[model samples]
Target: MSERPDISTPEHIRQLVDAFYGKVRVDPMLGGIFNGVIQDRWPEHLAKMYTFWGTVLIGEQSYQGAPFRPHKDLPVQQEHFDRWLVLFRSTVGGSFQGPVAELALTNAERMAAMFMERIGFYRDHPERFIQ
Candidate 1:
């Protein structure tokens, strides 16, 4: 097997989003949820993700939207988030390396934790969480 390239540019971010979403689309665990929400708007969603990750990994500031709002009503569970992290880590590991890739993984893990907390998985400390 060949070594993965470093994720250091907007194009790399785009590639990561595209490849990751492609896997998500066919993933038995996540496919249903994503396909249900995204439906026929894969292009639009992909574009938004490209912009989102680009803005996140770089300082592009091209994306303009709330990242967590769309997932507010999903029937996600701990297993779902865990599975997402697994898939995300696999995708990133398979595609890239270096500080940018590390940052991507860190950000993904943080996002998963935040999403879980927001969706009531971590209700033990309700006072510390946002309303």
Candidate 2:
């Protein structure tokens, strides 16, 4: 393996997001849910993710939307989030280092926890999620 570099550019974010989603697209546990929700919109989803990570890691303000709303109703649970973190950490760990990489991992952990908690909340109170 080559020396990993810090994630400090749009291309780095693109690489990470692209590679991570590439894995997710084929993952048995996650693929069905993601592909079903995304289907022909993978490109759009990837672009949004690039912006989302760019903003989260690099302080860019490009992404502006509710990241959790799309995921609130997904048929996911702790295992799904666990798989996601494993895949994500492997992707980032395989190619990145330094503070940004750690930030990405930390942010992912927090995001997953928040999403899971929110999903559980909505599940217990479906009426709160009505549009």
Candidate 3:
């Protein structure tokens, strides 16, 4: 019998991020919205995403970037956020397998909820989210 190899490393996270973005980059709703905005900084963004996943799954602290600041200026409405969540969930579901996928989905859901709440708060109280 062969023992299962661990598949939740930073490399795995990187693969997942790449796969996720592959879908996102082609998404009709999200593609144009984030293209020019994040094109130049995509590498850094991917690294940060990797760190965020690492922190969540492997107890790593490599992520120290502000996530919300970038999107604050985007043309994102509530429906766009909802579409993003659906696309993200679909991406993860298509790319991952087993427990890794489950963990990723759970974390993604939490993040989507938090982002929606933040957007709501920002809409209602712009002063609160101001940097």
Candidate 4:
């Protein structure tokens, strides 16, 4: 097999986002929540993901939104995040390597950890951030 290339371009971000979500959409542990939340809207979701990754991984000033707000109320917990990180690490490992690739993995792990904490905080203190 050929050596996977490091992520370096807009197309590469798209490839990573697309491939990652393709797996997410079918993953038994993650699919239900994602599919339920995003039913019939995969295209829009994937497009946002491309822009999000492009912004995060390549310094594109395209995505602008509270990336965690939409997920604060999702019925996810530690196990969900664990599965997500596993799939994400697996995807990154299967596809690419190098600083940028490592950045992607690192960022994913951070995002998962942050999201987990935020979700718990939101659940416990709904009055803090919610109306």
Each candidate's TM vs. the true structure? 0.88, 0.96, 0.80, 0.95
Clash-forming residue pairs, model 3 = none
Q: Which residue segments of model 3 deviate by more than 4 Å?
A: 1-7
lDDT preference between candidates 3 and 4, better one: 4
Q: What does candidate 2's lDDT look like per residue over 1-131, in tens digits?
A: 57899999999999999999999999999999999999999999999999999999998889989998899889999999999999999999999999999999999999999999999999999998867
Once fitted onto the true fold, the runs of candidate 1 whose alpha carbons sit more than 4 angstroms away are 1-3, 121-131
Q: Which residue runs does candidate 2 get wrong by more than 4 Å?
A: none
Two-way TM-score contest, 1 vs 3, winner: 1
RMSD of each: 3.0, 1.1, 3.2, 1.2
Model 3 residue 120 lDDT? 72
- Model 2 sits at a Cα RMSD from the real structure of 1.1
Rate residue 39 of model 1 by lDDT. 94
Name the top TM-score candidate: 2
Ten-residue stretch with the least lDDT total in model 2: 1-10
* Candidate lDDT values, in order: 0.86, 0.96, 0.74, 0.89
Write model 3 residue lDDT over 25-90, tens digit each, in one string: 888988888776887888877778888888776677777777666665566777877787787777
Q: Choose the strongest candidate by lDDT.
A: 2
Q: Write the per-residue lDDT of candidate 1 for residues 1-57, one digit (tens) a residue.
A: 787787878888888998899889999999999999889999999999988988988
